[model samples]
Target chain A: MLIFIGLGLNDEKDITQRGIEAAKKSEEIFVELYTSPMPNINIQRLEDTIGKKIRVLSREDLEEKSKTLLELARRCVVAILTPGDPMVATTHLALRLQAEQMGIKTRVIHGPSIVSAAPSFAGLHVYRFGPPTTIPHPSPSYRPTSFYNTITQNQARGLHTLLLLDVNHEKKCYMTIPQAIEQLLEIDKEKILENRILVGIARVGSNKPELR
Target chain B: MLIFIGLGLNDEKDITQRGIEAAKKSEEIFVELYTSPMPNINIQRLEDTIGKKIRVLSREDLEEKSKTLLELARRCVVAILTPGDPMVATTHLALRLQAEQMGIKTRVIHGPSIVSAAPSFAGLHVYRFGPPTTIPHPSPSYRPTSFYNTITQNQARGLHTLLLLDVNHEKKCYMTIPQAIEQLLEIDKEKILENRILVGIARVGSNKPELR
Candidate 1:
């Protein structure tokens, strides 16, 4: 059986009891660190807390050599763990679809996700906020202009946008609050007509999470 | 202080380990029924699983007579149990704001919510979903044409709308799949929409959930 477990958001304890149980029972555990990472915890802490030695998989290992993971799932109970909710990234969905084609039974264990937690913890109405937008790190050579456009459109309609910053999991590069604010300010500089109150959320699913 | 604990989507076991621990220590535990309900488990079963006596609070009790709940929070650790993630509702946010005004410390323990669970279970990309729209039950005297307008607008922008069925906690009325479909068809009345695929998910966060 192929099971996808979300490590929730912040720390080892952020994982649900059901998710932890599935990870413990799995014959092989694989943690995908490409998408996102728990801000307050690391692989060693997760292994100690989960009581399982989890093999880490990079983006290339999962996407390029995915046959190895699928082959393992064909016979044993393989648990694929991702930060936050699994299937948020298209790569994970591709993996699940591939597993299904191989006649492997698949199951997903839901975990606490920032999509809902962001609005809830920030004291914002879930329904009032519009669709969320991701903000990647800006560079002089290449800036994620598409993300800026999405946030601008959402703001035009008087909707709040949950901006997910870009993260480089291999280098462990996470977009911090100051960097996100700087990127937004830079976009606002080119487009002077936009003015919207942006909310910054960090360490979601943790006690006393930083919210502004 | 009043601590809002989301019971997650399905059964009592879906509650996080932290939520269960908090419930065990709380002097009074109240479950708000108006916002949402755990479909797989009832009040009694939840009480039995959590090993605590729970009181179901109506919308009136929460909105009009919250003083009792507030007072209980001041005396001991009071848990306000909610289905799905707590503070997903506007009233809960208002309650939290009120608690702040009264000098009561509040803490929100995040839980699994449908906003993230739906896309994960449906195999849809989380970033692809636009602003979700709720389809309310049409009234005899009032025909809601705006619901269709929202759906059309969302489609025009290449965004999928999450059709949340109406929840009538006062009458124990849950808008099911068939009922919601009928309402949408009645509102739109378009021939091209009959074959449009719509995913139905129920009992999320359980070991075994239904997906159609």
Candidate 2:
């Protein structure tokens, strides 16, 4: 069996008991933390809690068909853990599809995700929120405003948008709220529209998440 | 202090370890099962798992400014547990806002929600899901098709719509997939939209969640 365990938003303890149990039963366990940054994740602490050693998988490893992992899963129970909900990243979903196509059974140990947690913490109705968009780190050749378009459309419909901050794990940079605001403001000035109601949440799913 | 603990999707074990810890520290813990139905929920097993006595609350108790609950929260730590992630409903958000207005601190111990999980299980992108809408049981006095509108809009944008199956706890009626499909097909004929791809997930967050 192949199990996808979500480590949730914060540290090691954020994983559900069911997730832990699933991880404990796995012959091989892999963790990918690059998708979303868990500010308080401790490898040692997590290993201690789960009583199993977890090898970290890079984005490339997962994107390259996850051959070895799938092979292991086909032979024995294997688990792949990820930040927030395990299958949030497209690559993971693709991997699951591949595993299923290979006739390997897969299971998901659900975990707390910022996808739903953020709106709740902000005391906003989740249903009123439209499709979520992520603000990318704009380079000279690749500047995008689709995220801004989403916000504007949602605003017209009297809906809220969950604007995700871009995370570049390769650069070890997690986009700060101020950086996202600066980027959005730059887009606003470029588009000549000033209407914006943005809620900046920092370190959500932590014990003391700062929200403003 | 008031804390909202989510019981997650299927059963009591779906609640995270953090949520369990939060409940254990609470002076008073309340469970509101009317919002969403947890088919496998066993109050005895849940209470034993959390090691606390949980008092069940009616929908009215939570909707009516949460008078008694908030009163106790002001004096000591109190928790309100609900199926899936707490705060998905507007009433929970209102209650949290009211608690904050009354100078009571509030915290959310996030749980697994179908909002994100369903997309993952279906191998669909969570970000591609537009505004979610619930299909309600049509009554003689009220027959609404707003949910169909949501799906059509999402389909136009090449996005997916998370159609929530309505649960009228008072009537002990949970909308089955076939019932929702029949309802949607009726609306599809009325709206003249031939494009539709609906994925139904049952018993998610359980040991066995059937998806099709």
Candidate 3:
């Protein structure tokens, strides 16, 4: 059996009781956190809470070498923990699908996610928020303008756009709100957001997440 | 001070440790369930875990007479609990905004919401899901068909639509998946959804929610 659990946002305590129980029942517990950032997360605290050492998997470990991980699950109970809700990142979704295809039982233990908290704490009606988009770090070869296009489309439809800033896991840096705005402006030929009052929320799922 | 805590899907243990801590810190805890349904929720278990009685509020109490609830928050620490992630419904958003306007501090403790879990458990990519649309119960005066429009727009954008079935609080009946699909077919004039393989997810946040 393979159980995918979300560790919620921010710190170790953000995990739900259901998640903790699942982790306890698993013969192997694995955590792979490169997909998202929670600056205050303490890995040690999470290990203590689950009462076992969590095998920390790198992005390559999960994405490229997930076959080995699945092999473990095929034989015994295994849990894969991620930041935010599990499977929001397609890598986890791919793993879940692969597991099921291999005839392995899979379950998901839900946790707090920024998808809900962003609208909730920002006081924006959830229904008004359109499909969320991420402002990616543009390279000369991979400068995608789709995120900008998504914002303009949502604005045209009279909806609010939820912007998620990209993360640079290797450099241990997160894309800042200002940095995202600068990136957006570079590709915004229509100037749709130039005069719009866009709300920026930070530290979601934390005790004191703020909206600006 | 007022804290909006989400109890998550299914049962009391679905609440994160962060949520439970916030409940324990509050002088008064109130739960409003009319907005959504969790058929397996154990109220007594929730009370026992928090070591306090939870004041249950109806739609009338929360929507019509929230002033009394806000008044209490102005003087003491208060926590309002909800079925899904708090403030997904605009009612909780209104109350939180009111408390903030009254100079009372407000915080949110997000839980496992169907918004995230539905996509996760169903093997659907969260980013592909567009602005969620709800199938509202139609009264002769309130028979709105805008949900069909939202789904069509999402399909045009090459996006997946996340359909939230309506909760009829007075009748204590949640709009079933088949009922929602039947409602959709009734208004699908252009045959947009008639041939589409729509996925239905039920009992999300529960121990055993199924996807079809």
Candidate 4:
């Protein structure tokens, strides 16, 4: 059995009771933090809470060495934990499809995701928000501007947009709200966002979560 | 102090550990089921899990009589329970604003929301989903076609749309998947959805949740 569990927004206590139970019962547990990284996540504290030791997996481990995980899952209960809701990332969805093709049963245990939490924390109605977009850190040779088009399209429809900041867990680089805003401004040289209001939320699911 | 807590997608166990702690600490707990309803939710079971008596509130109770709840919140910790993520609905956002205007402190405890869960269950990428829309049970003189337009807009961008089925908790009238599909077909006489695949998710966050 292959179980995909979400670690929610931040730290240990954010996981649901069902997630905890699944973690405790799993024969092998692996966590991948590349997709979404919690600001205050402590693997040791989460291990203490679930009473299980978790092996951290790099992106390559899941992308290239998935056969090994699938082999273990085919024989025993193997749980893979992802930050926020599982399967939201296409890589996880692809992993599930691969596991099923190999005759492994799969299940997803949902958890609090920033997709919903960000708008909620910003006091924006979820229904009024358009498709969320991620602002990737631009490379010298290649800068993507599709996210800007998405925001423009949403704004044209009078809908709010949730801009998820890009993260590179391997480099310990997380995008700050100010940096994201600067990128947006650079992308929108037309000054379309000059009159727009942007809400910056930090450390969601933490006790001192801030929204501005 | 007023804290809005999300009950998550299904039963009592679906709520995060933080939600349980907030419920236990609240001097008074009120749950409004009009916005979203969980099929397998048992009030008694939830009460047992949280060790607190929950008072059920109607839409009017929150809309018109919010002063009463806000008054109690000013004196003690009051928690308003919502199915899925709190503040997704504009009514809850308005209530929170009102509370702040009256000098009441407010916070939100995030939970698993269908906005993310539905796409994940359907094996669709979350970023590929456009703004979500709701299909209400059309009344004789009040048929709304905005949701259909939203779907059309999303389709134009090669994005999937998450259509929420409307429910009337006061009448115990929850819209079924078939009913929702039929409504969509009726609203889109242009047959925009004739060739499109619609994914129906039921009993999400339950032990026997089904997706097709």
Residue range B1-212, candidate 3, lDDT tens digits: 98989888887888898998889989999998888887777889999999999999999888889889989988999999998899788888888888888899888888878887787778887778778889898788988978888888889988888889888878987788788877888888898876688888887766677788
Off by over 4 Å in 2: A189-193, B189-191
Highest-lDDT candidate = 4
Error at A30, model 1, angstroms: 2.8
Worst 10 residues of 4 chain A by lDDT: A10-19
Candidate 3 lDDT over A1-212, as tens digits, reads: 99999999888889998899889989999988898987788888888988988988998888888889999999999998999889788888898889999999998888888887787778787778778888888787999888878887888889888888989897887888888888877777877777789788888888677678
Order candidates by lDDT, high to low.
Answer: 4, 3, 2, 1
Q: Which stretches of candidate 1 lie over 4 Å from their true place?
A: A42-52, A189-195, B42-51, B189-195
Flag regions of model 3 displaced more than 4 Å.
none
Indicate the worst ten consecutive residues by lDDT in candidate 1 chain B: B186-195
- CAPRI quality of model 3: high
Instruction: Record all residue pairs in model 4 with backbone atoms less than 3 Å apart, i.e. clashing.
Output: none
Clashes of 3: 0
Question: What is candidate 3's CA lDDT for residue B114?
Answer: 83
Candidate 4 per-residue lDDT, tens place, B43-118, comes to 8988998899999999998999888989999999999999888978788899999999999999999999988888
Report the C-alpha displacement of residue A24, candidate 2, in angstroms.
1.8
CA displacement after TM-score superposition, residue A40 of candidate 2 (Å): 0.2
Cα distance off (Å), candidate 1, residue A141: 3.2
Report lDDT (CA) for all predictions.
0.79, 0.85, 0.85, 0.88
Q: Model 4: per-residue lDDT, tens digit, A134-210?
A: 99988899799989998998888888888899999889988999899889988888788998888888998887898
Per-residue lDDT of B99-154 in model 1, one digit per residue for the tens?
88988888898888888888678887766676676777677897766667666766
Give lDDT for model 2. 0.85
